[model samples]
Target: MRLKILLIAISLAAAVPASAQTSRFSPALLDRPDVKRALQSVDERATAIVDEWIHLVEIPAPSKKEQARAAYIRAEMQKLGLTDIRVDDMSNVSGVRKGSGGGPAVVFAAHMDTVFPEGTPIKVSREGDILRAPGVGDDTSNLMAVLEMFRALNRANIQTNGDLIFLASVQEELGLLGAKHWLETSGYKPDMFIAVDVGADDVWYGALRITQFKFFYTSPGAHTMESRGGPSPAKAVARGINALYNIPLPPIADGLGSFKLPVVNVGMLGGGTVFNAVPREAWFTVDLRSLDTPTQDRLTAAVTAAARNAANEEGVGFRVETQMGIDYTKAQPKQQRLDHPLVQTALAVANHFRKPGTPLIAPADVGSTDANIAVSMGIPAVAIGAVRERLPHRLEENADASSIVPGIKALISLAVALTTR
Candidate 1:
């Protein structure tokens, strides 16, 4: 009798469809009335947000020179009625939204600086639905998204359970110096962090470890005839570059939890002036990256040793220095775990906004972002952008205008969900 009952139950269960299963927490958030209103508001303001993007991009905000953009963001945040607004020494502008219910604090930040140097033309061109300009999509889209989210939240009058801090960070293109200084100096410690950058549909939970080194070679200069026995700084720099490029890299792991292989590249090299003269000084920059921190450290050591040895061979002064002329070279922090609530929430919310059978982001597609500072300090953090962009760090960078609405919607939903938690 018991066996018959169990078999009958199993047969009945098999008749149920996949759609009948319980909805995920992330997808269910969309069903709330307030969330729906917020999404609609974002959609309504999408065009205005693009206008804001063009305006912001036109402002010159290169790394370490974000004063103009910072002031602009500060004024906008003030207009949005954010409290305790402040700009730090690094030009990191931030504002706070106090929650009615006491819960964790969450920060949403987008960098204000662009990879383009000062004086780069940021004029926008419209071709059909696409908007083109220097730094248009790399981060201008994200900065606008954050601004619009703040506006929508106020317009919709949606109150969260936790405090929300909105930020327009500076110096992100200069190795995340702005974020690092702000994190160390600011007394506010949020439970979760979301860094807006790069892409809206795609998410990055894991922050890749990075180490940049600038090798400077120096020697007494002489003409080719007089410098036959003298050390050559240029030759030393070349030897170091060759050794770094030839260093063997481990294969990327394909396991469920493992990350991809490390990478090392010499991004810039500068040396001699005249062809017939032995240059007195030469310099080269190396950017080393790894998903694993220990591996990154090991590889950094190897590169440093290689450069120093090469310098010794050429009898030139080879000093290991930082790329930014800082007292110590900066390194990327540890990655966020896939299972962390912040990361999982971001992934689920991203998938919720995408079409069926489309993967918005994955744990393995990690990159360096401002969230690296938070993640390094054991804080839950994830990096996202306002929309899909093309030709980042180039003059032709652009983003899909249609994606902005959904992108901002996802950001709002994610913020609400994290705050409620």
Candidate 2:
């Protein structure tokens, strides 16, 4: 270990003799013949692993209720020879593959729980090349992929300088509660955090995202026939929504501001007893997201300001409630930069295996993801697809069965590159 660290230090401090990329970023050709053989061996086991994942998926694990699934994952990890594996307080299951040097820790996490409630039929069946099920692509496939990746690494005895941590998180559908808890509780802090709960084999590279909210207002309630008085929360919410609608969002975020052009949505609204009574209180949800802190902050302020203004002008109590608890904000803030070596290394792997010169897609998504937490909470993170595809998270969500191999190759290559140096 000491020797490995010294070597890494020397390498980092000076250029290599124009030679090999660090073990992490080595070209697509497997460095060790034995590693290639191991990967080949995994070929026969793919169906079995897929079967196991399907079996695990059938065991219903709604948000916050992942004990059974987590327990299953723990047993699987133990079977795979990982050490220090356990389910954490937030029901996140973790196991570590410790390495040989004084290098960074890397985390790859997938949520165990799905949005479906308990008793949802999670039966798996092959619909041609696609795997059709509620949580199959949203996460089950990734969880299974983690096992396959680790198994392949172990088979090849591919060693690393950095430690690898695998996590089966909980309640991602419920706002990343499991991630929030694990980040708070994990004794080890990772230099790289990878959230593997996305669909498609592509990625959003070097982008960090945040979610903020707005409140809608309605006038105090009175008989519709008589007490129609103040501005209604619903109307206030509508006005804010309109204001948001009028404000055009940029195709790309302005990089250095406290606010971005607001992209807003009024998702929900309710506060009334009868058709005849004007609602005394009306509350609605507004979601705003941005790629940079300044823009995100600016948008949040606009949403709040809009809600307040709308309420005051309408003579109704206009109050906005922000999403509270862990998912909304990080326990700590992460830095913004695109030059992390790991990010670069992953890009190298992507470019190597994927079609040449295809630029990494940094398209910002409005949806909130667990990756948002990793970035917001100080982990240099990138979210990507292992098995790329379309129709993810829809009723037809699936990974291209053939693409799984390339995806595996990409993941393995990226890991090798980052962990070696």
Candidate 3:
């Protein structure tokens, strides 16, 4: 019976109309001679783009301190002959290239901040096709891709029906703060937002819901011998970490539906001085993630409660501060459908460049990105990566020089496709 059912399903699938399959390329758009020239220009300029990537990555744009790098990118945008250029109070740099004024306003954004701290020597070293440096691959590659796309559009003089807004957002690594603030306060809300991040392997439609908490445990300090019977903040923090990690995680799947469970992790933990002395304070950070708002809240509450309980048992003061996160309750049109036009167009671009017989773009995975703010606000948003990288957020971070051409090509294609849609 099972075999019979499977055979019937296969027959039904085979009988589906060809029109149901999304086209990987738009004939009219691809046939344009100007588009061909534009793409070629991107290919020709790919080497220069990588050079810009190295230069920008070495500028050091840590979380809240992105002024210098932001200024650099703003100047670069000016060099592209883009109009209406400006940087916001939060340090998000943006500019506009006016189109025919008939289509949607498309925003192409790349985060300008890195996870590294300020003053971390960002000197980049090249070894063959690999460029190694802090903040090199994680986002600098994508930022350069944005710049190259702008240059191609201007060079090709490819006019679209809508405005193409180029954006370099700040504080993205600090938990989407820049994006969230810009979306909420900026007078202009884009009809479509594309966050250029990560690599060329896949496009992400849904943004992950994330909650970060800094757990602080306070107690009286004393020498180890005299610290007996007094609550130890370090012990309380350790207990909280153990309990939080022990929280059962749901099976990880790339499904388009509501989430029932979450994956919890303790990212940073530290709290103690010398061995002989008991530290008066200690704190650790927790990263809680899920697609379901209720689940995220429940898990966050559980973790916070655990920390409090530990503190109480140890006779120490405990507190949990929301360091960075998305308020699930505030998001609008929460889940974007898998078949949204923007998403399909992105897949089309992916399929256009994807190796033959390789799978199309992967299913939308949960991630915390700048697009999260746009997606939460019911705006059609997607995030894509521009280069290949081995290690991200590490001192040894590196990107493949070979990935630059296709990466920028994909961005240019997707932007043109969406703008003309």
Q: Model 2 — which ten-residue stretch has the worst lDDT? A: 328-337
lDDT of 3 by residue, 210-277 (tens): 88888999977889989877778988888888877777666675553334336777888888778887
- Give all candidates' CA lDDT scores: 0.79, 0.66, 0.79
Off-target runs (Cα >4 Å) in candidate 2 are 1-23, 28-31, 117-121, 214-220, 227-231, 251-262, 324-336, 355-368
Better of 1 and 2 by lDDT: 1
Q: Write the per-residue lDDT of candidate 2 for residues 327-388, one digit (tens) a residue.
A: 33432323232445655565556656664454543323322556667666667776655655
TM-score between model 3 and native: 0.90
How many clashes (backbone N, Cα, C below 3 Å) per candidate?
2, 23, 3
> Which of 2 and 3 is ahead in TM-score?
3
lDDT score at residue 207, model 3, on the 0-100 scale: 70
* Candidate 3 segments exceeding 4 Å error: 1-28, 254-261, 330-336, 355-359
Cα TM-score per model: 0.88, 0.80, 0.90
Which is superior by lDDT, 2 or 3?
Answer: 3
